[model samples]
Target chain A: MASQEIETLAQALARLPGFGPRSARRAVLHLMKRREAAMLPLLRALEAVNERLSTCDMCGNVDTSNPCTVCADPRRDVRALCVVEEVSDLWALDRSRLFPGKFHVLGGRLSALEGVRPEDLSIDKLLRRVEAGGIDEVVLAMNATLEGQTTAHYIAERLERFPVRLTQLAHGLPVGGELDYLDEGTLAQALRARRPVS
Target chain B: MASQEIETLAQALARLPGFGPRSARRAVLHLMKRREAAMLPLLRALEAVNERLSTCDMCGNVDTSNPCTVCADPRRDVRALCVVEEVSDLWALDRSRLFPGKFHVLGGRLSALEGVRPEDLSIDKLLRRVEAGGIDEVVLAMNATLEGQTTAHYIAERLERFPVRLTQLAHGLPVGGELDYLDEGTLAQALRARRPVS
Candidate 1:
């Protein structure tokens, strides 16, 4: 249906998290059509990132710099550290502008089925960061999955002996989540953690 | 939320047909994680295509070769040409292997809303191809939209003097379309084109 180069590009694109074969094909066609406006820019950006990409030595966040933007920023609160499962989680949290602190990426959570044990993650690095002593609070902002909770709990136990306070994200109905469509666990959590009217 | 290079990559990816900001971010992260497996291959493919890309002078098809793969294939029925609105349409038609003939891409259809005129397309070139000789049939394989039909009609009018047979794709229910879910226009077309049972 197309050239080998176009097919290869589509195959690589289809491997992305949200894209399929049809969408990848569409994307390839679009890129081919808009070579100057889209294709060249994307190629240049990818090459630049690939050439300069590095992980933060302090946290596990990926950036062109060794310390990452968040870790190197003096304006960010060094006393408050947020722990997350991956770099994407860190980005999601940072996008909110609510957490004015640095982040620690665990690389991945403990998953028995996937054989991702505690040793597989950057737990020792996280412990080392806490032990280095200036952080006041450690927020475990893991997902609401069972594995996420298990990882949070394990991290909490390790940080208990440290002077810094350990906290996890509050579980309840998400903003704009319809009560009728929500699951029983979410409803129960929302009810148990009900807030008083001001 | 990310560095300039990663953000630029995400923005460029988001401009793709099916991708949005969120999906683009996820794709960027995926690319970053599997740089060797995914990102480098995509970059290399893009570079190779960019450097070697050419349009067929005869058929307007895009390929590394000037004649393109379809136009260069000696086995294809050159006497029977399939005219389509875009390169993507040509690819779609060829993917089915139902059209053994060559293809001519119009670049786009006549669209009053978008200000696309007949002159803006490859219609003149199409007429030249038909005028230059031994073509027996020209299949008008435009989309089912109003603009598509209008463009097809305009082309048919221009080709009325030519000795070649001009044909079009049939309008009916799609292969897997359900009768209950089908629109009135399709149902009417299907009924009007009803065939005798074997």
Candidate 2:
């Protein structure tokens, strides 16, 4: 039936983050109705990107090349490494343009409920990369979640025996955010990590 | 060059109703990250639908055939016609399951500011269809906006000489809506179009 095709399309669309069945239906209908104006170009772009894309062999970033543009670039600091949970997180960091170091994607955090262990992540590969030497520092830019904290702790502890300096992104009040508006946890972290103004 | 691609994609996406550059970038990044899971299927679906789609010669609705399924179907009531501003509006009416008549998509509402004239729309085609005879009624189901009202008035004036009965969707408080919560304009419309409750 015609409904079946719509249903299949809806299901596929629903798999996208923040899209439920109703939104999926609306999106699918919009795409189908505007096939010429919007859908065709979108389709071509998707096809072109998919045909060319691959995972970065060095740092696990999604790219069209083996090591990814970031890892392959000679100017980027391979001596400094930033670690993150997902490619999205890595992309977010890249968008900030604050750090000019190489990256290691952990894929996911240590979550007992989800049965995600360190071995299941790229932790072993990270250790191998770290032990190979010449790396000056490792920045744990994991999420502020409990699992992320635990993973960072585990990684830091494991690297304590190694010669590389370990650092984590500073925890504090967000820029442009009022102190009174801060959550209890963030406020406490900000207080604990306070430094004298330069 | 890479930034230009992102910018172009963002601009294209932002042109879609309800999507801005932030959402467009999120969507593009999501597609790029989940190339196999989301992007490939979306691309294939878009391509498949685009390849098969054609505008209905009679009704301007996108379909796999020239006349469209609705226009081609002999079982549908040809004596009753429903007029709407857009194909989406027609689809909404169809979903209601109350209307068994054929549809006339006006493509857009009358907007003097936008320089959208009646002739620029399918008004001539609609008049031709109406003049062909056998139509008992023409239901105006344009939106409740200023342009929608203006377009409805233009259509009504144009078809006033015809022998067909003209009707519009009843205007009142929406289902599950409280009169106290309605805006001044809505309340005025509801009051003007008040009916005797059984």
lDDT of 1 at A175: 95
DockQ of the two-chain complex in candidate 2: 0.38
- TM-score per candidate: 0.96, 0.89
Q: Mind giving the per-residue lDDT tens digits that candidate 2 earns over A1-198?
A: 123445566677676655676676666667777777777666665665667677787888876566777788788888899999988788788878888988999989999999999899999899999999989999999999899999999999988888999999999989998988889999999999989999
**How is the predicted docking of candidate 2 categorized under the CAPRI scheme?**
acceptable
- For candidate 2, please provide the TM-score of chain A on its own: 0.88
Off by over 4 Å in 1: B112-115
Candidate 1 on A1-198: residue-level lDDT in tens? 577887888888888889999888888888878889988998899899999888899899998778888888889999999999999999899989999999999999999999999999999999999999999999999999999999999999988999998888999999999999999999999999999999
Q: What lDDT does model 1 reach?
A: 0.91
Over the stretch B1-198, how does candidate 1's per-residue lDDT look in tens digits?
578888889999999998999989988988888888988888898888888788889888887677788998888998999999999999889989999898999999999999999899999999999999889999999999999999999999999999999999999999999999999999999999999998
Model 1 docking tier (incorrect/acceptable/medium/high): medium
Q: Write the per-residue lDDT of candidate 2 for residues B1-198, one digit (tens) a residue.
A: 123334455565555555666677677678777777888776666666667667677987765566877787787899999999987787668777788889998888889999999888999999999999999999999999999988999999999999999999887788999978888898898899778998
